[model samples]
Target: MRSNIYIGSKRRLSIIALGLIIFLFTTGIAHAQTVDGNKYQLTLAEAIRFAKSQNKLVQVATLEESAAKEDRKDAYNAALPAITANGSYQRFSQLTLFTDGLSHSTTGPRKPSANGAALGIDALFNIYSGGKQRALQDEQQSRVHLARLNTLDQSGSIALQTAHQYLELVRLNDLQKLILDQLNRAQTRLNNINSLYKNQKVTKSDVLRAEVVLSNVQLSLQENENDLTITNRKLDVLLNIPDSVRIAPVDSAGMPKPAIDSLLPFIESAGVTAYSVQKIKENIELQKARVKGVESSNKPSIGFYTAYGLNYPNYLFFPPVNQAYAIGFVGLKAQYSISSLYHNKSKVAAAKLRERELEVQQQANNDNVRTEASSYYIKYTEALTRIAVNERSVEQAQVNYRIVNTKYLNQLSLLTDLLDADNLYQESRFNMIRAQTNALNIYYNILYISGNL
Candidate 1:
């Protein structure tokens, strides 16, 4: 019975020990996760979103659009009546009638006092401006549309820039990984050489050569690390994140499928929808409206004005009286600028010339878009082809490295040959990574050029 009791105590102790180990292991893993959280892992879409939210260029475009909206509102309010108020006080030397012998106050006229004051409010509404008001309103609305299109253009620019930065960061990160792997292989090679030298199978020179190769790999590693750091900082600036924060992109899903051959439809459609093209079209409309406004300036403008007034020392009477009176009047007034008829002919001609210039400019923009779209599409296709070729090169390089490494391990090949093969292997991998990044960048470039970004 004592033996059974001792065994039971041992079993309980074992269970407690197992539980403690599990708890410690879980705590360590949790700590590691907490550390990783310090770095922000950004995806391509998220980076674009962040840039849109915080980029100064995007913000500036948005503000410009808002200002344009205010201008449009002002144009709308111009159609409403305008009300004004005025008050004046004057101390004249004397009040005299213009009639003959009005200075003979003792015989017939009584002179008024020197003081005069008046307060009045007037409201005027332009009943017609010969289409000037309508044309101005249309012009402002077109400007508002142009401003919106400009905002879209800025947004596309910022998104494309962010995407490029992110892709570069990914490329650098992968490059660092490749360098680290190469360094490990170099170290392993050095150890093997050292063992062979100790056994007298290889010369001291071989060991020294291996050491030099490892050092070179280490230097390369350091260079890649430096590049990674700079890339991270640049991406942080683009994201508007704190410079101290590190950002890393998770493994991307790779490049999107290319429809380069069918890109003609997209390119052709872009001319009508692209911001630059649309802005030019709006400009043409705005200039035409300006011509109408200038033409209207030559026609008669009729306005109705009404005012209520209080005047001290009324001057309406024959002799005048020292008293205050309330008065009101309303009337229609029409006036034409005879000089506008002569001057506006030239002005209208200039405006029409400007409109025609914009039309020509718009045609140029359309042609540019077509050329740019086709060029980017071709570039994207070329990048895709390069990726495929690099993939095959990487495979061949891996095989060559393995054969050279095996021969060196068997003391049948020189260390220099092995190092050369390893360098080629590393270079192949780097090239492949660069090709992939280039392909992704070109893909986005196509989208940007097509105005689909």
Candidate 2:
């Protein structure tokens, strides 16, 4: 009876232990999630969105665009009339008295006090500025357009970077899994060889060789894990997420099939209008506008001005003294500056030179875009061919590994042959991964360089 009670107690203790372990494991997972801030199932679209929102480069570019808009607005407002108000007050220590020399008597000053105040409003309307205002408006418009394009360019660049990093993280994750699988196979083989050596069916050297292979596989696994960690960190930084958070990508989709037929057409269409190319072209226009503005500066400007003022102790003869009165004036005017004329020739020459330089740069940039697109296309095709070839190689390697593995089991093949075949199979798989990833990267690069991304 006592023995039965002890057995029941033992069973209850085991059950309690299992429950504790379960509780600890569940809580551990929760703690990991909590420490990492939040778990995000990041997708390509989501990554791009996050980068656009959080990237400092994109933010700065947006601000520049806004500033350019304000500049354009100011330029537009320059064509409107300007109005200003003025006021002044003065207090004298003593009043001035006019004396009659013949009578030797001083007539009392008309004003009761030595203090005075005046207020005025002045208005000016620019009738003409020799087209300088129009030129300025055009230049400002070009700047605004350039700023907008630059913002788009910045966004495209950030998106491309995010895609590259995300793809690399995915590739590293796949590679780590592959290496872990290899390590597992090596460990299983090592165990088999150890048993065979103990039974005297295999030599001690065989066991040592197997152990060495297992250690190498383990080292490879460790290196791959480290690589995964670093790649994850890079992606986290790009997404502006916490580094401690572990990302498990659920999108295991491999490289997409390329639409070869449309790729060249898309590149050609997007190449001409690329933001970089367009910005340079617009800069040329801006410089031309500056030349016009410089020429306009040497010409004359016509305007109209009007002013009305009220003053205490009116000094006008028509207005009675010792009283506040109003004075008004209106006039048309024309003015020319010889200072700008002195430098106009040089300024125009400099502006033309800058415009020409920009044209040359624009042409060069267009050529570069074409070249980059062509090169990326070639790389993508090569990757496709490599994928096909490596896929065949993997098939062949798999068959060879199976045959060698069977032969080794039957003692009809050397362990070296089996190990070599296994290594070949693993290498072929890695090659396939490389081919696929390279193809994906190059295709996206083509899109990026074309400014279509």
For candidate 2, write residues 278-297 as lDDT tens digits: 78888888988988887898
TM-score for all models, in order of appearance: 0.84, 0.85
Q: After best superposition, candidate 2 residue 87: deviation in angstroms?
A: 1.0
Instruction: Provide the RMSD of all predictions against the true structure, rounded to 1 decimal.
Output: 12.5, 10.8
Clash-forming residue pairs, model 2: none
TM-score of 2: 0.85
Candidate 1 lDDT over 1-453, as tens digits, reads 999998997776556434433433554422211124336555676667667766788888999999999999999999999999999997765434454566444332234766789999999999998899999999899889888888888888888888888898888888888888988898888898889899999999998888888898889888878887888878767655555557668645254555667666666777776777777888898888898888898789999999999998888886788887889999998998888878788888888888889999999999998787778777878887888898899999999999999998898898889988998999989988888888778777767767777
